[model samples]
Target: MDAGAGRIGRALGPGRRRRERPEVTLTNYEAVYDFYGPGRRRDGFTHPLLTFVGALYAPEVRIRPETVTELHRLHDAGVGIIVAANHPSHHDPFVLASAVYDRRVRFLASGTGLTKDPLFRGPLRPVFEYTGTVPVFRAKNYEGTERAVHDAAAARLIGLCVDRLTAGGVVLTFVEGTNSSADDLRTLRLDSVKKGVGQMVRGVRDTGGRVAVLPIGIVYRGRELAKLPPRRPVVSAGPLALWEDPGPAPSVDEVRHAVRAGIDDALTDAWG
Candidate 1:
């Protein structure tokens, strides 16, 4: 039917007590975030990894921001950026990752691809893990009776996303729930978006963190992967998901519709 996506990542914080122990003097996440700070260019998916991923998978993903003024402005704020894009290829994450040439970016990576699959167990595993890519297991693939199990897994990953988002991070995701069939590899399916994204925006706003949901559309022409495409990423972030201060947590269906409309508009802009 469709492909997969990440649920929430692991939630970071204290134990059940939920108290900050000043005596401890440091946090596990603080060390982690520090390692992946602005100067962490050399650690994770550095320039070398981008080259490798491009050469092997998506060669078309080069960051020549034609009109990403607002996009960069949001990134400079140090809050969090939700880069919502369409999934037309398995190389979507790598393509989006390239856009952050001068900054850092994280994404909801497929757990199966990163762990169970042969392609990721070797060199790619370490790179993705280091670069802040949270691996998510799609419970929907289990189909019928296994929904509850997948829900738990998804919640954990989402908890992790909430913390990182409020703490200033850049996340790339395919809200369409699966890959599209534009390349003839799969059907161009844009069924619907999961509600985790909406919750993230609301959660961040509730905590007083400024979050921007930039609707990014990725378009591919023909079925070639090696040769560069005529058009690249389109950055038309105008009417964001939460433009002003969010009032209440919107319904899942409402957020889903907004996400679709925004992505559709961005895609139209990219094509023209």
Candidate 2:
């Protein structure tokens, strides 16, 4: 086995077979690197680069500054939190990160976005590293070259790094797992949710870690939350509810409802 294969073998274990997805073509590696590489290094500086760009480039979106201001307020109140929100658009991550800028939370992401040749990886991976962003491996299913990368991640358990992030501090996750074009939220693939978040919450419960799950709502009214024609964004933060001790790990339904509820409440207030 090569170095990468050796890595994944240890982390993900030997039981599962690798699967392939046509939608996720690897040929666009250059395109991905060109676009996402530089931003990775700039992720931590000055209000998260994307948020600043969105605000400047898409000023018409119109999200009240007060929404983020409220998030800061909660941070000041001393809450160790994990924020879960709906991923309606590509910009959702930036908008969500901006909402909690005052808190300085780390993000957990899929490894597929970061793995690459060293020349490209160096500049592109640091922002993820700086912000405590850890990667979850998605390459375990391939029998050939992809399997090699999967094995690398599995060996390091970089995919399981969410457990470490949750143990260390707050980590944000997009429970939906992927971005959606429609405003209507999709069903949480309970299995995916279980693997990432369930493991985090369960780990804390089994051992000991300060984990507070918080539901946040971002209301992008009118053209505020657009990714295509770029628009101004409006975001709202909801009051947090902590899960009880030994409380069951939140189900996909539970989390979705909470997040959706928060979003609904936020939209109501922002529009009204």
Candidate 3:
């Protein structure tokens, strides 16, 4: 057998036929918006599955009690929350979910997770689909008209996030836009914050409501950072920074700075 077939055989084990790959077309943003919009049914399976996976992989996940209490207070106040977290490993999502298991939250994730390689398609993609993750197509990944289309899609995702916030839901976003290695994690500093987060906050403010930006920092401790199922993981939550609609709108840079500072604070707490 060829190397590719041999690998597939190993993944499937001795006598099983290969599962047929689904035809995943890149649909327009309108379709994506409608699918995850307010009227969509709540998922009954994904959360439990995520918690299970997190337990199995990151059994030593640690989170502060104060963080939990803060989250409760914000939710009790009926404020929309935007969780801005630093991305250290792919395991960060599962770790964050396990940390904040009490709250129903949606993630703002890359569209590539939907159409990427086998690892993503086989196991991870379904989690994104079922968990109401807003898939964002990075314009840099495309060219010409395709880039323009994807850019528009990314913009539409912001509006979808605003809708979620306006309806009193929590949205978790990785402000760095990509993952960093454990070696880099030692510094405990966030990478450049993305502008999309600011856009979502601004959109929510435009609709006149109370919104809170909650920053979370995730730290992974393991010999092999790239290995599946990370080792001990630590999560820290900074105080919720509230923004009310009546004040002057925050500039994108201002929002980025706030999120950056918040994540840094969380990182310090996580290391402590």
Per-prediction TM-score, please? Answer: 0.63, 0.51, 0.75
Clashes of each: 8, 16, 0
- Order of the predicted models by lDDT, top scorer first: 3, 1, 2
Name the weakest run of 10 consecutive residues (lDDT summed) in model 3.
108-117
lDDT (Cα, tens digit) per residue for candidate 3, span 1-272:
89999989989899864644333323445665555444332357665775686666553434456656665676667667887878777776666666656343223221111111223235656666565554555544444546657667777677777877777777777777766655446443434677878887888888886788888778764532666666567777776677854887677777888888887777777777
Candidate 3 residue 186 Cα shift, in angstroms, is 3.9
Writing each residue's lDDT as its tens digit, candidate 2 over 157-197 gives 32243344343445576655555345443322333332444
Which portions of model 1 show Cα errors greater than 4 Å? 1-45, 51-67, 102-123, 140-145, 181-190, 224-239, 243-246
Report RMSD (Å) for each prediction in the order shown: 11.4, 10.7, 9.6
Local distance difference test, per candidate?
A: 0.50, 0.45, 0.63
| Residue range 138-234, candidate 1, lDDT tens digits | 5444456455656665555555566666767666666755666544222222355667677767667667777767665665544424344333433
For model 3, what is the alpha-carbon lDDT of residue 146? 67
| Position 260, candidate 2: lDDT | 52
10 residues in a row with least lDDT, candidate 2: 108-117
Which regions of candidate 3 fall more than 4 Å away from where they truly are?
Answer: 1-27, 38-42, 59-67, 102-123, 144-147, 181-184, 187-191, 222-224
